[model samples]
Structures are given as structure tokens and as C-alpha cells.
Target: MTIRFPVLIALILALSAVGLTYEIAAGRVLAPFFGTSLLTWTTVIATVLGGFSLGSALGGIVAERPRAVALRNVRSALVATAVLMAVSPTLLGLLHSWGVRGTDGMMLSVILVFFPASVCVTLPSPLLAKLAIEARPGREGSSLGFVLAAGSVGAIFGAILAGFVTLPLIGSTATFAACGVAVLLCLPFVRGGQTGTPGTTIAAAVFVVFAGLAGTPACQYESGLSCLHVDRQGPEVRLVSDGTMQAAESTAPGEASDDGTVGLALSYTEWFWARMDRDLGPDPSVLFVGGGGYTLPTKLLASRPLAEAVAVEIDPLVTKVVRAHMPRAAEMIARTGFDAAEGDGAGRRLGIFHADGRVYLNETEQRFDAAVMDAFSSGSVPAHLVTREAFARLREIVEGPVYVNLLDRPDGPLARGVHAILRELYPHVEVVHGARTSTGRTNVLFAASRLPLAPLDSLPDRYSPARISDARAFTDDRGWVGHR
Candidate 1:
């Protein structure tokens, strides 16, 4: 009886470890299609927790009878969970490809992956507890606590394994699969475990059918303004758009790009370089918050001696894609004056850190001469990146002048928002509207600094034909106020 209790505790711990690993892996897998936003993570966690609760409640009812029957139920539950976990990622990939873009698509995907998998996975604990209690006949509290503690210990190992070993080494999908396999392996060891039955066969067939439907490929259209490509790479349906790559499976690839550099208008990149050439002197140190095509980085190399240039991009895939497809950009980065790093690294003259620009600016002790807020676009502006609080953080990190690219038209939402935020944050801020092109919209340069604003007369003579217009003073509190 003593031995049986300990074995049940071990089984519970092992099942928990598998569950926690699966949760994190699921988040990474969904990130490419839905984005790695707080909303998406919240949905994933909530769904999983809800599933766990449901499974526990249901398992308790089923296991109220005999010890042997409960043990068999627990084994069945583990087997079911293993099957679901194995196929969840593939299912998510299909849903994402079926024209499911943005927040709505992401929420649905999370529900699909987490609901069934968590329900099956969570059943083992209660069933195991019932069996242990029936076998020992008394002292349920002490026995259950020991089992729960073991499960907690297993959870800690699972988290560590997912973060350090599984995620980094084999990638998310494989890690998830491994976790599922671990759960399946546990089934055979449980007391009263059955080998195969007609019911089990039917369940397996149902799982297979669902997996097939989920793994089926769907066609996608690409927008010419932004490059988009979809390919099945192993367990994931990889979507690469505008040099940014995301994996659509319950497991995220370690190389997925999280920074806000992809899908940006090419005109923004070109205009930014042109503006940099006009406003800043040659061989100056350049700090870029978002790294896209390395368009500006390459141009900086061509035009200047390249004293020092730092690009802080959060997405490793953007950096990787630029390096792979854009040789000129990569070469420019390799040149002595340029340093490419993720957004988290510290810097003086030049360094790259893979981190949030707002967070980095607030936390960084280093300062830059030319800090560019090249992080936003027309469709979506990262609100936090453009908030008054964010600008205050930028002010602390910048030593000289700050240049921000605003997606604006004659009267655009972005332009209005830029004007409002700038008015609140800077003592001296000026907007330089550029010419409209074939591309969707024109852009405005919002130049601001704590130092005296450079007068139009004192501004460099080489300003592009794009920048011919005089700086406009924006005094509206409501963003996009004039447009509405």
C-alpha cells in the first residue's frame, strides 16, 4: 500500500511536467501568426487553465467508484492527452493559413490547441489521487500533499527543461512532441493500464482525422507592398513576410522574429536614409530602434566613413533574413563602423540589443548622438512605443537629436498621433512632411530634442526634394483630430 501511494505521486509529477512544457511551447508556436502579444499569451494560459479545471472536475466524478477502475481511467486519460499534444501544433498551423490573421485568428488557434490537450493532460492527477486513497484506505491528506509536492517539483523541472534545453536545442515543436511522448510512456506503467481496446482504437482514429484536417494546407495571397511567403517547414507552417518570419504551430521556433521591423513600408526605410544623410553629418554614430531590411544600415555604409552604427532589432529572423537575402546590407553590418545586436545589449558608440526600445531607453545608461524611432507604420502603431511616457524614456537615452518616422498623409491618423505625442513630450518638435509616392502613404519626420531645435535656416542644405516643405507645428491634443 505504501509503495502504491509513492508510485501514484511519481505519476502525477511526471504528468504535470509534461503539461507545463506543453503550455510554453504552445505559446511560441502561435506567436508567428498571431504575434507575441500579451493578449495571445493571456488566451493561451486561460484556455489551458480552464481545460485543467474541467478535466479535474470530470475525472473526480468518473473516479468515485473503484480503485482499479480509477487507475485504468488515469491511464486512458494520459494516452488521450498524448495523442492531443502530438497533433495540436499541426492543427494550429492549418487554422492560421485559412485566412486567419490578427487577434481573432490567434484567439481561435489558442482555444483549439489548449482546450482538448489540457483536459486530457489534467485528468491524471485526480484519478491518481483516487487510486492512491483507495489503496492506502486512509491518510488521504498527507498522501495527496506528498504527491502534489512531487508534481510541483516536476513542474519546476519541466519549466527549466522547456526554457534551457528543449526550446533552445530542438526547437518548440520537437520539444512539445517529446513532452507528449513522455506522457504516453507514463500510461503503460500505471496499475490496471490496458494495452488496446476497441474504444482506444476509435479514439485514436478520431484523433487522426482531426489531425489530418488541422494539418491540411491552405492557400494564402501575398501583398506586393510587403513580401509574404508561406511554407511547410517540418511541424510548422512558416509565414515569412517583409523579411519577418513567424511559425504557426503550438511550438515557436527559437529563431522567430519578435521585433517590429518587418512589414514596414519600404518608402519609410528609403526616406529615413535620405533624411539621415541630409540632417546628420557624415561618419556619425547612428542608433536605430528597429532593424528591417538593413536598408538604412547599408545606405549608411555607402555614404559615410561609418564611424559607428548600432541597430537594435528584437527579431532574430529579421536579422537572419537580411543577412541571407541582402548581402549588401550584411556587408555593411560587417564593416568596422557598424555593430548589429539584439535590442537588449548595452551600448556607447555602437551595440545591438534584442529588447523593447522603450524598455531599453528607460533602462540603458548609454546615450546616442542620432537616435531614430523607426518602429511604427500606418496600419498599427505600437501604442506604448508612441506614448508620452515612452518619449520621456527616449529623451533619457539620447545624447544629441531624435528623429522619428511618422506614417502620415495630408491628414492621416499616424500623423495626428505623432503630433499629439510630440507636443506632450518635447519642448521643441518639428514635422517635415515628405512627398507622396506610388506606395500607400507619405511619411513625415518628427525631429525633436531637449537641445535647441535646429532652425529651418540652419538645417542642412541637402534636404531631399522629399523634404522641401517647411516644418509644421502640431498643436492638437487629440490624435488624428483633423482627419475625423
Candidate 2:
């Protein structure tokens, strides 16, 4: 009628491992919806720890019950948690497919998919501790410490296994289903927990496989780095990252106007010509620092055959998908690395490099006539790249105009702070508010150069003259845009 000390510690360890495994799986589940940003991670950590804090406190109270009753409750909690795990992937995947977008969608999905199981999985930890202490009455402190430490170590293992092994190798469905089955392993340790019947375990295993079959997450591509989602509305095909619309490309083709004005699907990209070398003449070697949809590069190459073009993208999977969408440019990316013969000398050619923008800029010997930075959106700009040191390096690599397209409000830290930094980095800085009305703006483009910028008038809806000055400019030590 007594539980063994080692067996009780093992059960507690399994319980903790299952808890952390589910947390990692929750991140993968939400990646296509919330993105894997600082904000998203903050939310995940809070949600998980919050549930555990509650469950552990309640488990302490449950420990006062008769041993048989507490063990029965532990078995029941494990079963319920596993059943929810089986259903979660399909349930959340369907929610995502039904148009879950932005922060609200992320919170809703987390509440549905993670909150219940997180609470259930930890209920047995304190209960296992109580059982162990009762079995070895004089060694209570050792029993508690050993059981608790065992749980923490198990969590560490679970996190590593999820990231480096299971999630990538088997995908989210099987990984989650496997975690659910692992949760059931703790049930055998429930004292008098089993009825000596295979019926329930057999049923749980079937449910795991069946739900896993239903659990394939909606994704354009789910890589170790990201989850991509593609959406099309009319001729505009947009690439979405972490639920945010990162870039848009129009399938509808158009030529330059009679006056030599270029056409583009996104107004932000169109702003590139507002003060760029491409406006003055041909064969200007241009570097595009972000490759979201490769829309800007595609636009540049199409508009000027003599334009030397290069796009540096961090995610090769994203690049590959967008390349398929832009076959000619994709062909160029695959065939060319850094230097290629200009297309018309025979022609100006484009080369793509799969590297981080900062690493590429620092490492590449080539100096660009102009450079475009569309690498980041508002909340998740790479902190290291937003600093003063990064801008100084960019100024070195780009001898002419450098245009930075930012999806931020004109007055926000990203637009305002970066605007201030550009003036210090380059002599002539012009802020082009791409989506501005008299009321406000959300997308701002910073054009800077050592030379004079071309005369540009504030056009209605297309672009307007804008500026912001503030005490905040990002540095490598300070960390990130939009963070105060």
C-alpha cells in the first residue's frame, strides 16, 4: 500500500517533461498565427507559467485528500490532458484557416489549445511529492527536493528534444501526439491507478494517431526559422510572416509610363524611386536588403534591364517560395551568387545571396550605387541591425542613396528614431510617408545620401514629405525598434 520513492520521482519527472513539451508544441502551433517574435514569446511564457502557478497551488490543497482519492484524481487529470492534446492541433488549425489574424487571434488560440493542458499536466507534481514524502516519512526534505529537481531537469530535456529533434523531424502533429502518449506513461504510476484493463490505454493511443492525422498545421513553409502563410486577393499576392502581412506582389504586369515613371504593387516599394539613382540614369547597381516576396527586386529588374540588382534574404525557405512566385528572378537568384555579368553589357543582372543583411553587407566587397532596406516590420526589427554601428557600416557599403522602408507610424520609435539616425549617417535625409494622408501615416521611407536628393513634391496618397526628430536612436547595446 506504499509508493516507492524512485517510482514517484520518475512520475513527477515525466509530468514536468510533458508540460514543457506541450509548451514548445504550443509555440509551433501559434507560429503561423502569432509569429515567433519577442511579443509572442512573452505571451507564451506568461500563459504557461501562469497556469502552472495556479495548478501547483491547487495540487498542494489536493494533497490533503486520502491517498487513493488523490491518485484517482491524478489519473483523471492525465487522461483529460492527453485527450485535449489529441484534439488541439486540428481544432486550432481550423481556427487559423477561418481567418485568425493579429494579437486577438493569437490569445484566443493559446487559451483554447494550451491553457487547459498546462493546468492539468502540473496537477500531479505536488501530488507526487506528497506521496513520496509519506512513503519515506523521515526524509521529507530530500523527497521534495529530489522530486522537484527531477521535474526541472526533465523540462530542460523536453525543450531541447522539441526544438532540435522531434518537431523538425516529425512535424507538430506527431510531436504533439507523441507528447500526449508520453503523458499517459505517468498514469501507470498512479497507485492502484489502473483497473488492469488495456481498454483506456488502447483508446488513448488510437486518439493520438487519429488526431495527429488531423493536425497538420496550415503553412506555406514551416522551417526551424519561421512559418509562412500566403494569401491572394485579386492580382495582389501577399506573403505573410507570423500573421503579419510582410509584403505584397501584384501578378498583373504593367510597363513604365510614357514619362518614365515605374509601376509597382506596393506603394512602399514605389517610394524607392522618389530619390534613388535609378531616377537619374541606368545601370545603377542596387542592393535590396530584404527578400520577403522579392517584389522590389522583381520590380527593379523589370523596370530597368540594365540595373544591377541583388537581394539578401535570411530565410532560404521563404526565398525559395517567393522565387517560385517570381520565376525569372528566382532563376537569377539560383544562378548568380555575388557578381554576374551585367545583363546588357550584355544587360544588368541580379544576384541573390542567402545571408543575414548585416553579415552580407560587412562581408561583400561590392559597393552599391544605392541600397534598399525592407528587411523588417514594426515590432520585430532585428535589434542588432537597428543600431548606430549597423547604420555606419551600411553607409560605408552604399556610396549613394540608401532607402529604408519601414512599416511604422511617422511618429513611432521605428520611423522617428531611425529618421534621426539617418541624418547623422547621411547628409541628405528625406522621410517619404508612403501611406500618408493629412491625418496620419503608417509606412515611412527614409532616403539619405551625401549628395542632394531629387526635388520631390508631396503627392496625394502616393507620398508626402515627412520628418521626425527624437532623443531615441537605436544602438547595438540598447536593443530593437519600438522598444522604449
- All candidates' TM-scores? 0.70, 0.81
Give the top-scoring candidate (lDDT): 2
Per-residue lDDT tens digits of candidate 1, residues 224-280? 122234455543434454223421221234532233122212444444554555667
lDDT of 2 by residue, 1-484 (tens): 5678898888887778778877887777676655565666667778888888878887887777876777777777788788877677777877878977566777777776777878888887888887788888788888778987998888998888888787766667677788888887777667664343467767876888777766665465666555677788876777787556677765555644443333556676666654552344576788888778776666666556677777887877787677666444455455443433233223336676777888887787888888888785323566666678888998888788888876566776677668777877888887767664432436777778888887665343656777576757778787563331
Whole-model lDDT per candidate: 0.60, 0.71
Q: After superposition, how far is residue 22 of candidate 2 from its true place, in Å?
A: 2.6
C-alpha RMSD by candidate, in order = 9.6, 4.7
How many backbone overlaps does candidate 1 show?
12
Cand. 2 Cα-lDDT:
0.71
